[model samples]
Target: MNTQHEFKFLQYPRKNFVRNNWSNLNGRWRFLFDDEEVYTHPSQISQWPLEIEVPFAPECPASGIGDTGFHNRCWYQRTFQYSKNSKRVLLHFGAVDYQAKVWLNSHFLGSHEGGHTPFCFDITDILSESGEQILSVCADDDPLDLTKPRGKQDWQKDPHSIWYPRTTGIWQTVWFEEVSEIHIAKIRLAPQLERWEVGCEVFVEGPCFNGLQLKIKLSCEGKVLANDTYEVVHKEVHRRIALSDPGIDDYRNELLWSPEKPTLIQVHLELWKGETLLDSVYSYTALRSVAFSGDRFLLNGRPYYLRMVLDQGYWPETFLTPPNSEALRHDIELVKAAGFNGVRKHQKIEDPDFFYWADHLGLVVWEEMPSAYRFTHDSVERIVKEWAEVIDRDLGHPSIILWVPFNESWGVPDLAEKESHQHCVQALYHLTKTFDPTRPCIGNDGWESTATDLLGIHDYDDQPERLIKKYGSNHNIADILTRYRPGGRVLTVEGYPHGGQPIMITEFGGIAFVDRKGSDTWGYSAVQSSRELRNKYEKLMEAIHRIEIFCGFCYTQFTDTFQEANGLFRADRTPKFSLNSMARATRGAGYSRGELTSTPQPPPLPAPDTEI
Candidate 1:
């Protein structure tokens, strides 16, 4: 299906899981900007007065070039039709904002500089056997580049405070992949639900790899359980496979995945030279894990509290790009119907169809890393090579399960007396545990923390008996920085030493709901009704549920992005308190700061391109 969107929008436009070829080079192109960054592609411009729209972002007004200032060069042209006969076409690019340069048919064909991962280019001898083929793209983007990661976008000209507009060129989805040069380049999937098993690395691409040959399956609804077959002999291949891998033993431990049951399993590899199959793909995974214990947050091993929220994956009209895929499954079923079992996607690196609708609707992502507010050496080599290709393209997503890699200290701000900013946050927390050593790798989230497994903090304290006397118990780190975090912001950065882990108040209650209307209605305490926003959100979740040394809390968002109004909805997502009173002030109520719970409300969730 080659989507050209004039707007009946339901397009996931390929975030991988292709079976029958693939095409969708989004719609209406031919645009021009070149604010002196000097034209480099689009066959050196030959009059394209402006049309914009492919994967929206001409500072999006559904991209008819709303031009919200900051230009920095741009050009995009389109024309497509391949009439298949592929040997290796491959031209995908589901992202492009910082630097991109391509031209096919006019032939230049390559240039990608990480605007949030996904990149490709093969052009198979610049194909031209039948009709149409033009495809051009040029983007440069630098809204005052702080060395490039540019998350909450905006660098002045309009949107402010926690940044907002400024995205250039193709903002995701522009495809054309019909591979067969011995395909399947990459698929990690570690899994292992405490050894029920599943390793599978696989990374092939043409010739040598000892005559190829690999197959694997692991179904769910169609039921084939698990199967295996290997012998690729090097192009990176690992293996494990085993739910009980011989015939799958009647649901052994029955398909586990959580946030209250997410399940998934389906994958299907295939590639062969010795048998002529050549290549195939269609993936899926989840058996979930997410560990950490002492201050607790287990998951398949039990505890699991994280009622998170921070979601800055914006979209008053596709800012960080996502207005489809059922508005990313209605923003993960409206954060699991306002009770939040997870979502800390804060500095934005979202849209893999929002981690496939948060792994098929159960939700629990954290996956942060999108900063670069300048710390030099090319912003730590563009944040460790685009945060290790966005954690190797979202490490087999079992709804993410945490891997922040620097937040609060925006881009290594004197990381506690800089030893090269604590060796660039301990080399992005040991390269995010050497690419997914089973999730949870904070290293720098909320406060000044250095190497962390989770000790995040950012207290906005609208008093709930002073957040129950500052985390109700253990107090070290200069009395948790001058008695319960008094703005000196310290959590653990003087040579990292709070090793009990799990402390997440990852940015506290932003409050603000006073009559909404924006000119930046801001937050961090504004309430003037909805019964004082449910009595200060049930007294700040009853002081993090009577302390017990706090295991989780993310709030400070989940809508109202754009001059951040302390959203608990309302930035056009209504609900200023009442998804069953904000899911009983965040799930399973009890310690009541008194008078509220009437429960019933649940209706208003429709307009995400309507349907339902």
Candidate 2:
């Protein structure tokens, strides 16, 4: 992170589950475009000509260098005081686009390939004892490369229909941390609802972890409820602490996390060597369970309907990167204020800070992977690697209940006809479950689902009666919809069957209302009056509510962005219609509420006629 205070970009520089002894490196940095990728250590050459803020890519206007054109390679250089100590120092990058190589004081550290996952390097050996050190980063990003995951980042010279400007290079916070020789490298908390215990997986890094014991204390409102100590011999250790332990009889009252009341259990972790404290860190977790029974999506053992919106996570100035931490929290608040229990993050793997805010604000999230435009061995390998990294980085957050590996078959287009494509989708579904069996994994959202726990589909039909006719029936699943849908596509592929999974209209109700007359804004169907918009919204939601099989519905968007003017709010976050009306229309009475139903009802009407 650059130490230039005046040029600091990130308001919340610290990463989630943070500790003290950390410094923010998000300020003015010397930047230069390297199209040919010639320079290994660009700092050694002449001074960089351009100055851009760290974490905001050059393509973004907030970066102070709004170069939206194609530049395959770029270098960032900054200097900060870092005195070497007995402990290890780690340099962390929240995320960098495509390929990133780091150098410390002219010494090469290493390179990371994924654009969406956080990566770090131990720079203890290369640090100076007392003086300043030069830190440099080189990123090579190709927007046109279909082999890598690019979610909503337009590859063309200009922002196209749906896709926006590309975000290249560092687009998230960067920081430095000081840790003990044997410190906690990573920790994962999985709440075992049935067992009434929280499973803790701790990964330590050092030459030796012998004689080390991990002491954990779970508390709420300054009162400790459960405490445990486990001896650790291996680098990776797994331990479980029962919430029903002694003195924890009221655990359910203060421990369970939900959208209405998000309660976080403070965790005080300590690493000791025979009574000597080796290291200590602070963390937090929430107890929650997400399951699917027949057509109902269960949250903590009961049916909970998910009222969600499609959040593209874009801003006028920052594009994919938010301008500040306040913006992240504001979005969550807006979702809740506008009567939404959750958000399907669309195709982007968002910053961990967003997830942190969601967890704190009690907003459920469907964590979806960014899509690759084409399907190939390279695309498959890259998507799998990046998605695995993303899962590993964010699986600890309780707000994230579902993992969506694909969206509308953006990459695997021939899933219905090609056998290999079906196999690929199935492979990804099983792969996600293998990593995290706790969360339901959606193989491909919307259509052509090979293997998925959640059956999500997209429909933008303007008429409410048509939607009611399409889904409200009691016949075979294949006969539910016989004609083409709003976008001229089948509801489900030919061979794939609804295998009793929880279903949702993950994308729908994109009612377009343009505020400006001359603007080129549009939606699925344009409405001229606010009253019409409200009536349409209510009618559509009423149709959705009548279908008991649907566990949830996600409207097209939260706000208007670029050419997509179908948001409930404008691009600047101003309400397009009355907030109360939108809340009433999209959220009809108890259907939109997150209230849990103890007894799951039977599925909705089975078959539908083709006409409205």
Candidate 3:
């Protein structure tokens, strides 16, 4: 394939289960709004009045129909040529907002809910005998419904305080892949840094066969580290593969993964049944560990201070969907250029491409679930279900260091008083830990925390002196948690007192610079010029660095998202101030203990044994 086509296919919905051959069904598609809910099936829609760009919501300018008005329901139809062959076809949707029902050739395929996670269907049987196949989708998203996870989407007519435009339907990639009758369905790689081993779990689908085997290969820099094969007795197989330990710190550090040095261990897997290859996939992972030591966050068994920026993953043209794959990489580059070692993906499960780049470019990510406003049975169920899928989809990425299930008591609004709300928070926290115990899980990020591994405070006070005074020492922190409440919300729930977990200001410093004239924008604090912004930012950094108790800090945001113009860069990604100035302010003289340094380049590795 040519470079453009290759790039298109490389935008695979899932990074872990990637295949070389696949079709990109993105470009233009027939579209229409179904506000009246008249069409229940694709056959009922008589005419297609509009065309929309796939993966971009109708509310976004890139979708061609940039109507930001309230339209709860919409329809999409597209046809692709597919010749029936020996292989089975699987259709995948990266994500659809709220709820989605799909049909192929007017045949009812299936339905999926939860806006942030991916869902797929086996479309082999539903394909038309002819070369062309018709695929239709009906997305029903209630704009006013607060019971579903909406992320930063506003339900109102226009963009509001913090929420931007709504992403209605097909906000992520849509494509299909051809696979054999039996293939690898899923794979999960868990890094056990302490033991110098990696736990591999593979799930296979199709008919049960006696001679099915899975071949696994691990390599780094063209040197083979491990090559093993296992007989598949059942659908799921788990094994721990040990790596040769380089006892010296210098040699071992090269194998470990950090934001400064992202050394990925390339993985190759092939499913075989009696010498016939059923499936083949290529993936990568790294060795890393995230933990807490008293008031410090430990990475690779050492105290590593986190300087993270809040990224909403929004663009001027595309609301939630990135315009292109390169945009995702560019965003990470921008974050690193600003001197932030990590990013808190605030209130949204970002596209897999974002995580892919983060893993490759060596940037830490805090994956957070979007919030549902109302706390109800349905809301709880929806958040829990989607959150699991979120974890399941992106669990293998080495860049992710933390899992944030709730933010600032969103969804569970009465968490401070209601016992049920507190239970819900605890439940979600435990659920996240149960799903993936490798990383630390934050129950409620901002305030009113319960059953949390970390205590995250979201104090947007722009005053640096007040911040220092609030979190200067252990006594001040304890006092603020018990007596003084930031944002009029208690730091922890009534029963769940501060448990001495590492504390960090997960949200702060939302200083808005009005780059666009008369744009009706706002932030926690506004500045008139770049100099003023720089002065205020530098002071805040200085204050944060002086705070001996804080383990880390996440600045308000990375880009100006809609009306909430509290970003280092504008919506177009142009920096508000000079990049060097921003980086200097972000890094600030140095940490009290020591200065942060880039990962040293690894020396040449010794030769490894040839694979059998």
Give lDDT per model, in order: 0.75, 0.81, 0.87
In model 3, where do residues sit more than 4 Å from their true spots? Answer: 1-9, 474-476, 591-612
- Local distance difference test, candidate 1: 0.75
Which lDDT tens digits does candidate 1 get at residues 1-612?
A: 224432222343533354445567888988888898666656668898989877888887888767789788788887887754757888888888888989887888878887877888888788777867888888887788887888778787888766788787688888776778778887877788778787888888776757777888777655777777778876767888877633353454367777565777877777777857777776778676788898888987878778888888777776778867777777777777777778888887876888876777677888888897879998889888888988887788887887988888888888878788888888889888987788879888777777888788888878989777776766643465445553466667675667778777887888877474545677768877778877888778877877776687888888887777778887667787777677777864541423222112222111222110
User: lDDT by residue for model 2 over 386-486, one digit each (tens)?
Assistant: 99999998988889999999998889988778888888999999999999999999899887777989878788887888887777766445565345353
Model 1 residue 552 CA deviation in Å: 3.9
lDDT of 1 at 219: 75
Q: Determine the backbone clash count of candidate 2.
A: 8
On TM-score, the leading prediction is 3
Taking all chains together, the TM-score of candidate 2 against the true structure is 0.92
Q: List, residue by residue over 213-309, the lDDT tens digit for candidate 3.
A: 9999988877888999999988777999999999999999988889888888888888888868888887788899999889999999999999999
lDDT of candidate 2 vs native? 0.81
If the candidates were sorted by their lDDT against the true structure, best first, what order would they fall in? 3, 2, 1
